[model samples]
Target: MPRALLRPVWRTLPRRALVAAAAAGLLLAAVPRMQSGPPDPQLGLFALRAAALAFGLGLAFLLDDPARHLTTAVPVRRPVRIGLRVALVLPWAVLCWTTALLLVPAPARPPAGDLTLEAAATAVLALTAAALMTRRTLITEPGVMTSTWLLCTAAAAYLLLPHDRTLLVTPDDPRWQTTHTHWALLLAAATAVGLRACTDPVRARLRPRLSS
Candidate 1:
C-alpha cells in the first residue's frame, strides 16, 4: 500500500509552489553575497530569516489535496498519507535550507546553529497550522490562509513580545540563549500539535472497532 501510494501522492504534491518558494529562499539567502562591499552581519541574519520564512510559507501548503474528499475513503489512514507526503518532501526542504545557509558568506554569517533552530521552529509552526486547518475545516487548500496567519503572527511577536521573551534577538544579546530556549520549546509543541492534527477522525477510528 505504501509503495502504491508513492506515485499518486507524488503527482498530487504542490510542486510549483514548493519549487518557487525554494527559489525565493535561495535568492534571499544569496542577497548578502550579492552586496558590493563587505557584507553586513545584520543583513546576513535578515537574509537567512527571510529565507526561512519563505520556506515555511511553501510548507504551509504541504497537506493540501484537491481530491481530499475522494481520497477520504481510501484504506490507508490519514496520518499515514500525511506522513508519507512529509517524508517525501522533508529531504528536499532540508537541502534547500542547507543551500540557503551556504549562500551566505562566512564572514557575514550569524551563528549557524542558532539560525538553524529558528528556521526549524518556523517551518514546524507553519506545518502545524496547516495540519490543523485541514483537520478542522472544509477548506482543501489552506496555504494562503495559513501563510497569512504565520506572517501576521510573526510580525505580532516581533512587535509585541517582551524583551526578556523575544525570539529575534541578536547573537551578541544577553537574551540569545533564552530566545533559543523558547524556540526549542516552540518546536516541540508544534511537532506535537501537528502530529495530533494529522490523526484519523473519530468516526474512522470507531469503524474498525464496530466492524470487529
Candidate 2:
C-alpha cells in the first residue's frame, strides 16, 4: 500500500520550495570556500548554520497537501502518509547537509556531530510546527506561516537570547555542551509532538466505530 502511495506523495511534495531551499543552502555553505585566503572557522560555522536554517525553512512545507480534506478517507493512516513523505525526502536532505559540511575547509569545520544535532533539531522543529498547524487549524497550506514563524523565532533567538543560556554558542564556549543538550531535548520534544499531531483526527478515527 505504501509503495503505491509513494509516487503520488512524491508528486504532491512542494518541489519548488524544496529545490530553492536546497540551492540556497548549498550556496550559503559554499560561501566560506569562495574566500581568497584560508577560511575562518567562525565564518564556516555561520555558513553551515545558515544552510541548516534554509533547509529547515523548506521542511516547513512538508505537510502541505492541498487535497488534505479530500484524502481523509483513504485507507492509509495520516501518520503513515506523513512518514512516507519524510522517508522520501530524508535521503536528499541528508545528502544536502553532507555536501554543506564538506564545502567548509576541514580546518575551519566545527564538530560535525554537534552541528548535525543543531540541524536536526531545527528541521524537526519546523516539521513539528507545520504538523501542529495542520492538526489544529483549517489552513490547508501552513507552510508559509510556519516558515515565517520559524524565521522570526530564529532572528529573535539571535538578537535576544542571553549568552549564557543561548543555543547559538561556539564550540569553544563552555556552554557548547549545554546548548547541544538543549538541541537534543528539542529534537525529542518536537518528535513527540509531531507524532501526535500527525495522528488522524479523533472524529476521523471514530467515524467507522460510530457508523457500526
Instruction: Candidate 1: give the clashing pairs.
Output: none
- Look at candidate 1 and tell me the lDDT of residue 201: 74
Per-candidate TM vs. native? 0.95, 0.97
* Regions of candidate 1 where Cα sits further than 4 Å from its true position: 207-212
Q: Write the per-residue lDDT of candidate 1 for residues 1-212, one digit (tens) a residue.
A: 98899999999999988999999999999999999998899999999999999999999988889999888879899999999999999999999999999999998899999999999999999999999998888889988999999999988888998877778988889888888988999999999999999998797689878999
Q: At residue 189, what lDDT does model 1 achieve? A: 94
Candidate 1 C-alpha error for residue 29, in Å: 0.6
Tens-digit lDDT string for candidate 2 (1-212): 98999999999999989999999999999999998788799999999999999999999998899998887778999899999999999999999999999999998899999999999999999999999998889898899999999999999999998877678999889889988998999899999998999998898899979999
C-alpha lDDT (0 to 100) for residue 135 of candidate 2:
87
| TM-score of candidate 1 to 2 decimals | 0.95
